[model samples]
Target: MDYRDVDIVNHQRGWDGYFKLDVYELRHKQFNGRQSPVIRREVLERGHAVAVLPYDPVRDEVVLIEQFRPATLSVHKNTPDMPAWLIEIVAGIVEPGETLPDVARRETMEESGCSIIGDLELITPRYYASPGCTSETVQIFYGRVDSKNAGGLHGLAEEGEDIRVFTKSSDDCFAMLRDGIFCNAPIIMAMQWLMLHRDRLRREAASTAI
Candidate 1:
């Protein structure tokens, strides 16, 4: 498909802190096979992340978490009832020496207090949370879990995290999706994937039950 387009002329760090900002000056090949004007763009360099959707096949339920997001509050200030807390699947940024599955398991424990039962099923090629302005790719997975004791408040105190966990049936999760309870990309994608693969997952789990 000859997808080659962007040509980076220069890239410089603009800010470095909890997150990084990179300024880029570049040109791209136009549809007419000519180079377009060089433009300056600033990109947020949030590191890669991993998210795990913990599902209990026997109970047809999933575990999720709620946490405060200052960005959401900043953007939706006029709505007094729009709390900063967001409902999402377990997720964490990739550390320097961590694998995707490692982040998934660690995040699952920190955010939901649920232990993943077996190997995680990779969703597929990772996705960018916002490609136009950020270089953050997220690896998604579906992990088997026992959601019997999955509800609670869990998070790392050192990280200033106060997370609340919830377990909901697959049907209820879908209803929340329809009701606009989940606004994050990872959660939406995971739920949609589950919607399509839930039955297959259940059948496979049943076949493997001993």
Candidate 2:
């Protein structure tokens, strides 16, 4: 409920660099209102991020990106055949002076070459990617786009990003979802949200056309 509920005995910075790691020693109130033994935990302090699913309601299509993630290599070492390149929606870390929508639009262009056509529809509230070990929160959005020319390789070379973009019909995307082709959390959540609201979004896009 409050800081009083968790008694902070000690804390120290475990690592300081591009990202931070913090180690905390604390005791919290138990189910029976008793104080539990002090426990030490290390949390990764990744900053917040924003993700946008670019959709073309008129064409019934969505733009996605494929990129390699070194983090997945460790998890797939035994499988060897499992691809480390993941399919995901456009996303970026929130810069110091940028708003969530700004990040969404900027990332959409950088990752997919798709310009957002209208205001982003907030799909989900802030959610932690890995609450157990990280303090990173992500906000998700659904934004209209013109996907006719969305497919291509795009990314800033200086940033070491080699992203391949794909513009797929909603049905195709849904099939990928059913087959577990998407491994990213934001992409899965965005696709599920689109599946539920696709019809309504199409109707709105139709009205705006006239």
Candidate 3:
């Protein structure tokens, strides 16, 4: 059934903070073509976000970043294998009036001190971070960049972000991916696409230079 088939009985704010929570009591058309009983669901109102993978074609490298995330604190503390600081590509939530591409480039600079040089190759139109609870969607891209000088600590002080930026050759990145070092979705998607198109991209870049 389409979204119109679902009825939203009541929607009210449950929490107001950096992230919002909306309480929903609704019913939808079931598979049997019948109305279902009302169910309560609390959805996180995170809005949209953007993530960009910075790839240096000439150098055949990528800019990566690491930052602490409190969401995984419990797992990181209890599970020895879990890391509190996650290895992630540049990502940030979309602010009011900013486009998806705008946020991608902005976050790239803020998190990694790298600016997107050329056109951004849209990797995924919508990467639903977690569809079960959050309404947050991410538009992912891979943009050309110069990683020669793209290393340092970044992120806004007011936001309490202490991002560590570094670069890794495309080969090393692939090896790390194979070792299952990355657990985030955006990195996985971007790395997989690079794995499938590295040769073609290199050829195109070489031709453009010559």
Candidate 4:
């Protein structure tokens, strides 16, 4: 008698590229104890990913990265004011055998040239990038780091990732969040989470100095 139950009539595979598309013909149970009409949905399967915000408590700064996104470029190509290059926190696809923290740290190092100093803090629970058309879920984390020497070019050539890493004060990051400079959801969410817990993190760091 579960109203959430869904019956799949047929599942078909579509384009097999970096992202695989899955088409499903399905029917769901209605609240009135009846089955609804068949619904066909196409889902993009790009696998799950991890996003990390590298924060240096001692410096009151956070490491951010910039990169060119083709998809984003297409969206802004007609708009002269918008740039194709986007600023974002460190993130990468979660490998099959790797844990969330593992990928977070690895991606942080690969993209930012900074080593995580303290333990990785879970920013929040995992979230869906796009539930309507994709099965991609993202887990975001807060990795404590020393950002004194965190800048430079990074990213794997094979992956076509040319990332530029930079560190900005927490205040500046917050301002960017407020100004809607970031187009992605994870960074904005992470920044909001940091705003709530930043004093605790800095206080912990300050206490450790004593």
Candidate 5:
């Protein structure tokens, strides 16, 4: 249960952007009585992010975001001309001195125009979206909101995020899952959790309101 096998001899940053580059000197002791060289690798210093899945009980719906994801097509697409449009929960990189819930609420407002936050639920925390190269940890949350008049594209002009928000019925969202309309991993997981807990959530909402 110990990760003491790798020790840093020297380290430094190598990149300048949203993420940081980290270099580490490692020493590995072989089980067969051998010691390897002082190997060095440029590691990625992961950044923290947050996402939210907003649900509306009265409307029986959830809000999702659709945007053009350039990276997906660059890495996974068979055709270069194809656009990698993604349907995902609202998310944003955590700003300095900001709490996770605060980031979630801010992102919700920016992406969906849902100014008020209701009951919040932690879905899960996860490692880098792609651990092999990027260093990013995402904290995900779910909550109920009033999606009665939610729609249209909204995002910060400075960040170049042209996001379109969609409010769909629970039944319709689940049907999209069955039909493979949702291909993003995090959104898929969130939807699956909703599927598993929908009944209990409805019961709780009913009892609490009464």
Candidate 6:
């Protein structure tokens, strides 16, 4: 296994409320049976968090939220006709004293008004959603949901969240994928998994308890 060690050098909190820091690190690895010593220069900080990809096999659809995100709009270089809204799976930072599964369930309720049941299956955790500047890593999960009673967009307005829920068919979702409709990585991965495992998941849901 390859590994890298990072040591914090100096740090200061930024005006944007983000912590910025300098870091010294050693890249330790063996390449092609040859020992390699590489001197690295960089600064990094603690990462952010993971998002959820909710799948409701019984409805033969997936739950997605449409919300406005100013950060994404700021990065647009084109004519800027693009809406500030982005479609994503339910997500939130893991609160202090809260476990991962709890965060997943809480976010599901807060963002979409849906309740998820059973154990969460871990999908993937990636470090530095964008390692260049932010110290944010995200873990992805797939939670089982009841599709029959799944309703429309219901979000916490107090949190500035206005999410529109969509229950989309696999074929339509794939079309959206081809047209670059989804920017969130977890959602894309979840859709890919659905494309592959929808049948099995449906069968399991039919036999499983509510």
Q: 1-210, model 2: which lDDT tens digit per residue? A: 566799889999999997899999999998898899999999999999999999999999999899998888888978776789988999999999999999999999999998998789999999999999999999999989998887879999998999999889999999999998887899999999999999999999999896
Per-candidate RMSD vs. true structure? 2.0, 1.3, 1.2, 1.8, 2.7, 4.0
lDDT of 5 at 67: 96
Q: Report the C-alpha lDDT of model 3 over 164-206, residue by residue, as the tens digit.
A: 9999999999999999999889999999999998898889889
Pairs with backbone N, CA or C atoms under 3 Å apart (clashes), candidate 5: 46-135
lDDT of 4 by residue, 40-137 (tens): 99999989999999999999999999999787666776876676888999999988899988999899999999899868888878889999999999
Write down the TM-score of every candidate.
Answer: 0.91, 0.95, 0.96, 0.93, 0.85, 0.78
2 versus 5: better lDDT goes to:
2
Candidate 4 lDDT for residue 12: 91
lDDT value for model 5: 0.81
TM-score of 5: 0.85
Candidates ranked by lDDT, best first? 2, 3, 4, 1, 5, 6
Off by over 4 Å in 5: 1-3, 28-40, 76-83, 126-128
The CA-based lDDT of model 6 is what?
0.72
**Per-residue lDDT of model 6, residues 1-210, tens digit only:** 534433333444433334455544444445565545644445455445657777787777777789888777666766375557888888787668888888889998887777887888777765467777656678888887766666676777787777888777767888898888887777787777777788887898898845
The lDDT of each candidate is 0.90, 0.93, 0.91, 0.91, 0.81, 0.72
In model 6, residue pairs whose N, Cα or C atoms come closer than 3 Å (at least 3 residues apart or on different chains), thus clashing, are 47-135, 48-136
Give the Å shift of residue 7 in candidate 3. Answer: 1.0
Deviation (Å) of 204 in candidate 2 = 0.7
Q: Between candidates 3 and 4, name the one with more favorable TM-score.
A: 3
lDDT of 3 at 64: 96
Kindly provide the TM-score of model 2 when superposed on the true structure, using C-alpha atoms.
0.95
Model 5 clashing-pair count? 1
